[model samples]
Target: MAPSTRRAYATGERSFTCYCQSMNRSPWPASSDLVEDYVTHLFNTGIASSTLSVYLSAIARYHVMHNWPDPTQSARLKAILEGARRMNGVHQDQRLPITPDLLRQLHSRLHLTSNQHIDQRMFGAAFTLAHHFLLRVSEYTSISPARFNPDATLCLDDVHYDRTMLRCTIKQSKTDQRRNGVTLTMQRAESPFVHDVCTGYSEIRRLLYPANFPFFMHASGRFLTRSDVTEALKKCLPDSCDRMRYSSHSFRIGGATAAAADGQPVDAICKKGRWKSASFQRYIRPFPNT
Candidate 1:
């Protein structure tokens, strides 16, 4: 929770304290129906579900710490959780990657229709780099312009020019096993479309973020969050499109799907994605109808 959320929780605690004092009674036990009612009140007042979950989890821990004998409280909480789960409804199915034609349509709208000459251009460059180069989102942030050595052959500066042979050392990836690990090297294959995107991203990196800092920083000079990237992609997509269902993780999915379509081996795709085990084969199973 944010500071305001924490403050609201504190205010509720103060009210509970005052109520207990007025009644000349000790704090309510977890088994008390009153505590359960308070949780419902919090939910009714439009508190975020994640915030409420945190508060309830803390309350549960406090009860456990105090050695409260509250079998009834546990039962009540279970019922409340089940009710909330039902009310929230079933989750939507995962949206697959936007096809190449749809992706081109999105690009046209963002590049031509909108007056996004500067920010949108940079945004387009980022996603294009992600989609085309199979670069992990973190790779952009982990790389730094300052890391470009005088030798020019060891860093991003060296290989970015030859699009066919681009390489950068990924220090920590989503699947890196060791606390400290060797760097990952990625090379662009034979697509001209992919080549242009990587070339454009190199230029955009210098234009948007400081050459002295991380490769992908915001206008405020802070490193971009994965959510920030998703929001930008959302804007680039058409209004009629349900691209809000897409996330930064979708970039990886898009890459995997594209590679799979290109007849890349499942093992190779898994290695690129840094999956720990072949169990990810579950995701590769074709839909029954498809």
Candidate 2:
């Protein structure tokens, strides 16, 4: 299994084990009836249907790996899962997109001071890069404190810039299970705000880091994590409500939504976002109050 898949399954299995322990039930060779009951319990806890499905998958994988009968495969359990979906609803809580107007506002409002100039510049560059490249947080920042594989992480050398274009190579991605990488290029936007921020960031980063260091870094010289990026973004947002609705994922969703609003074709958006399927439609939210 891929590292990402393994991590997800590990999380699901841990959740299952905790549930079994709380209920005084054995999870290793769980019965169909017990599995169904657990599914219902999880639904009652307000987990989305998609999350419940992942939990079930984890349970199935565990049973297969342990050479036990997979209770989740029972027809009765399947019906119970289907019923859980109907009862709980499948709609996911999506993050609000950060549109171009919002991006410009953040850029203008987040001013630099002598005391923290480097930090502000880093955040500005990181934010602009994420929006321009339609990047997931994990694509540009590390999630773990431990050392990451070069094949799965973005290093400083992955970025290349020319007179009019900025190109970034993603070493690996969730969609690229084969470990084959992809390159994304961003030309100077007509507004120049994003381009200017990115260029300033690159110049600052060159002074602070070695060639092979991770591209996104904190003031302390550590690689920026997802939480770090999110907190920085919150500081840039104008209000508490916008801060609450936005997250690292807002960059990708916002870019896709903005492109759609500009009348860009679906295929073009998918290509730029590196999505292999029509699932990109899910990211194109209607503008607020429209």
Candidate 3:
């Protein structure tokens, strides 16, 4: 399993163990009745059935690893899981993408200019890159945004620029399970793109962060966090758009949607987004008429 899968499984197992402890039941070698009870207890608490499935899978995997009978294989438990699924189903919220025009508005509204320090400039730059580069917010920012992760986050050295174009390297991504590095390049856009990049570059040397630091490091010596990015985006969103319905991910989808709407080929968008499968289609939601 991948590191993320391991972490999730560990979390599920821990939750189950805690529940078992509270109920005075053995987590390992737990009875089918006990397992059913636990699932029922969790389901009644409004836990999503999908999440409960992970906990059960973790329990099953644990039993397999221990050479014990898999309690999750019980027909009764399976029925309960199915029942939970039927009861809860899937609840999805529609997240609007941040289209190109909206992105331009964000830059303008943030007042990203020479007078603004890198702290203020960081949002515009980060937002622009994620849109243009189809970057996951996690690929550029830290897991928690407040800390640093040289192995994954965008470091200053990972980005390069020239008169005609800007190039970036995404060192890690969820899809690149093999840890292979991926690079994204974008030719400089019309006026504002050049201005944003130039302004950010001019401030980097004067700022406290070193060459090895995160590219979007705040003036306060912290990497620009996800919360900060979200807050900035929400601040600049047009009055008609619901800020609560979008997130850092909206930029990636918005870019893809705009590209498609502008007649960019699907294969080209797929390549630019580094998507190995046609799953990228789902990200390109219908661009609103607004």
lDDT of 2 at 23: 93
Q: TM-score of predicted model 1?
A: 0.52
By lDDT, rank the candidates, best first: 2, 3, 1
lDDT of 1 by residue, 1-290 (tens): 22333455566556555555665666556345656665666666666555555565445444554677532345786687567657765344475564455456556766542353554555565566566545556555322322321221122332345645544444444334232333433455555665565566667667664454554444444454455576676766666666656666555556666677778887777766666566344334222211
TM-scores of all candidate predictions against the true structure: 0.52, 0.72, 0.68
In Å, residue 59's CA in model 2 sits off its true spot by: 11
How many steric clashes between backbone atoms does each model show?
0, 0, 0
Compared with the true structure, all predictions reach lDDT values of: 0.53, 0.76, 0.76
Query: Which scores greater on lDDT, model 1 or model 2?
Result: 2
Runs off by more than 4 Å, candidate 3: 1-6, 9-93, 111-116, 144-146, 189-208
Per-residue CA lDDT of candidate 3, range 159-189, in tens? Answer: 8776666778888675564468888776656
Best of the two (1, 3) by lDDT: 3
Local error of candidate 3 at 27, Å? Answer: 18
Give candidate 1 misplaced runs (Cα > 4 Å).
Answer: 1-93, 112-118, 133-159, 179-189, 207-212, 218-222, 282-290
Q: Which tens-of-lDDT digit does each residue in 78-195 have in candidate 2?
A: 7887787677666865688888878776776556311467777777777788887788777878655445456656777898876687778988765554457888776775436667
Q: What is the C-alpha RMSD of each candidate to the true structure, in Å?
A: 10.2, 5.7, 6.5
